[model samples]
Target: MSSTTTEVLQRKPRNVAVNTNPEHGLHLVESDVPEPGPKDCLVHVRATGICGSDVHFWKHGKIGDMIVVGENGLGHESAGIVIKTGSEVTRFKPDVVFFSTPPYDGTLRRYHVHPEAWLHALPDRLSYEEGSLLEPLSVALAGIDRSNLRLGSALVICGAGPIGLVTLLAAHAAGAAPIVITDMDENRLQVAKKLLPRVRTVKVAREDAAKDLGTRIIETLGTEAELVLECTGVESSIQAGIYATRFGGSVFVIGVGKDFQNIPFMHLSSKEIDLRFQYRYHDTYPKAINLVNEGLIDLKPLVTHRYKLDDGVDAFATASTPGARAIKVQILDD
Candidate 1:
């Protein structure tokens, strides 16, 4: 067996870790420590940001084609330190660490091994908590890129969750003015308002949202938006985004929703609204790190809750509960 396969097969059952499955929700379990392969590094996880997708998987056992089989580690938005480097891992020194992403066991554990290519050096100015945010920030950057947002452009963002709020911040950094954001949860919208006092917040329901939200966006901003970011992925919000956008504008879908959503394609075509979609992300980490280091974007306020690794269950519960007042829940390893 290869080093990777041997490591998984040889792990002791008493190693404390977080395990998730459809049957038992999330619970603390003892799992074997992972061994590093060539070009791999064993990292000691310090902080892991709980993302909406993690909550979705914990609650529903799947997000589209990605499913949790047996007992799976649950986290991707994480930062950690390199404790051991594989024989061929020259890219990362012992001082480096990185955030976790897909197709890898998550970082909600004491230690995990990942390829050196996925590793990025944690800036000296950032704490583990802040570093954990890089993954989400990168997603926001990708969405901003897809929108082709310009400075001082009128913009509307649907959904005020973590992704929505980050997009709002990214837009602000890119000089999007008079930004408006909407969500069904008033608490989340309130958080958005605090982030940018000038940002207009709209609370609208999916019930007849296409008409009501379009009108609300127009009335609030005094005109249709030049760029509409449909971050909610709700069918209704997608439709509202089409209606709320101005002629020749763009509607960027940043949120992951059902496989098939019913959108007003004919209306969007008629208005010459450009429909754009941003899948996860690509090559956004360096820029995200730069923006944070420059103090141009503040991610600290978004971390509303912190839980110890032992409290993984409660953390997921809090994240899943609507109106629980959690913007971002981070799981920390001491």
Candidate 2:
């Protein structure tokens, strides 16, 4: 083979993954960095956000059936720069920072791989720190989309967590007239208020969401919201969503709570309201990036704590803390 060809091929990456077994917490091992196949691009990791799912794996060694076996990487939300691309790659080139997540190797290290379709160019105004946040922001956009949110629609979001706060921002940006947020954590609630100055707060536990809070929110908002975005997957929040939405409005389920909840199908069935289930996100990153680019959405506040890649453990712990009160915990790579 020619020396030039050899040099090009040698630059291709193999993948090294962070593995967690059922018996161990976090174990680091090295493997070949991954090389992109056609339609895929290789990203040099810049920032990876610690998510609740990662913490679940670290503590319990599992999240549902997504067990971390030999050589499995655990992370799904992050942003990074593209370093290599396949022959078929379009819309991006080497060194372009973009958002990568889910069903793709996470941006937790120096390198990760994802399809071109899964990546979105970070806005020029968005830093890697702000860019990593688009993943959660897209989720909030998905919640807004699922709720069929329209202009002047009133919204009630349960849980002032990151997802909830993002939903609040998305709903507000989408021109939903009135939005209310609820959470048990006063600190997180305070952050939510700062992040979204317009969002009304309710200090109610998950279990009491339906019973005590539903009617009160309706009275406060002057009408039952036409849309209820359930960012807290807690059972009672689901109940509140089913009961609190305007008789013929929609409820968007944005959070992943315990396996399933005992939903009030009677009220839902009788009310003829749509109970929409939102998945991670599809084709919404561009809009999310635009939202950030235009200043319609500000993500910097969501990042309450920062760390380097090596501090991943502390990052996950802070993320998992019930009341660390941080909305987003991010890890940066030097």
Candidate 3:
């Protein structure tokens, strides 16, 4: 079950937030701090990470058909502190608050009221910023878990964005060897290489990705990958993933793409490739939090930009700018 606090806001302290409209880019808005109902808790948002989907909404006001009809906030990757809880709530108390998935008003605001079932305690080992990263980390872990990667399995990640980088680290932890990553952006490729020096990195050319990626992968890594994780929604990158996977191997599509995409189905069938896909996540929060606490996956390096809740405009502007070299932009509540 899910619900947004936007509807039941109280007319007292003005809660500042950033909203995205189709015509008006991203602008600040004020709303009343919401009060929790039975089984719900009021959260004082501390840190919110800007996601690619958030940037997509800020720039185009929609991701595919999920457009901003009137006024909408833009943030889901978040962590905060629970200020109060309803009489019926049992699981959560006054402490650090966990985050939830989409279809809600988002966590860009200073305050939020959400159900206790959707909340998880922020571990003492992780800061609010690190806690916010659990969302994307969960996405990467879900995709990797579905790929069924085994020890010493050759892995190739298409697209070196936040998801791809996380997959690289997770694959290493899962015992995948000689990993190779591909991306068109030189900066992102450099960041990935810096993070994992042993893994091979490839910069995809401007031409057809599928036609050229296979040759490059074979040349650099000595063979087709046993598992190819596609983290970019770009059509060419998805095509490259199919071409880079070995026969009988799997190609896990983790990126959210357009409603329709044309792919080479014949090639996939002839190669006996297992084409898989990933949704947001499921049953991954505890595992992710534990992994980070154990230093198994490092997410702090991914946060390349920071902003205050008051600098909503500049923050969204930096996040929406193309090739900004910003892997993750975080907003700290004032």
TM-score of each: 0.91, 0.86, 0.92
Which of the numbered candidates is closest to the native, going by highest TM-score?
Answer: 3
By the lDDT metric, which is better: model 2 or model 3? 3
Which residue pairs come into collision in candidate 2?
A: 13-33, 14-32, 14-33, 14-34, 15-32, 15-33, 15-34
lDDT of 2 at 21: 53
**lDDT per residue (tens digit) for residues 24-110 in model 1:** 468887666677898888777778888887877777777778777777777888887776678887765432244322344567787
**RMSD vs true structure, all candidates:** 4.3, 4.0, 4.3
Task: Flag regions of model 2 displaced more than 4 Å.
Answer: 1-18, 60-71, 87-91, 94-105, 206-209
The true-structure Cα RMSD of candidate 1 reads 4.3
**Model 1 compared with the native: what TM-score?**
0.91
- lDDT of residue 296 for candidate 1: 94
Tell me how far candidate 3 lies from the true structure as C-alpha RMSD in angstroms. Answer: 4.3
Residue 276 displacement in candidate 1 (angstroms):
1.8
lDDT of 2: 0.72
Worst 10 residues of 3 by lDDT: 1-10
Clashes of each: 0, 7, 0
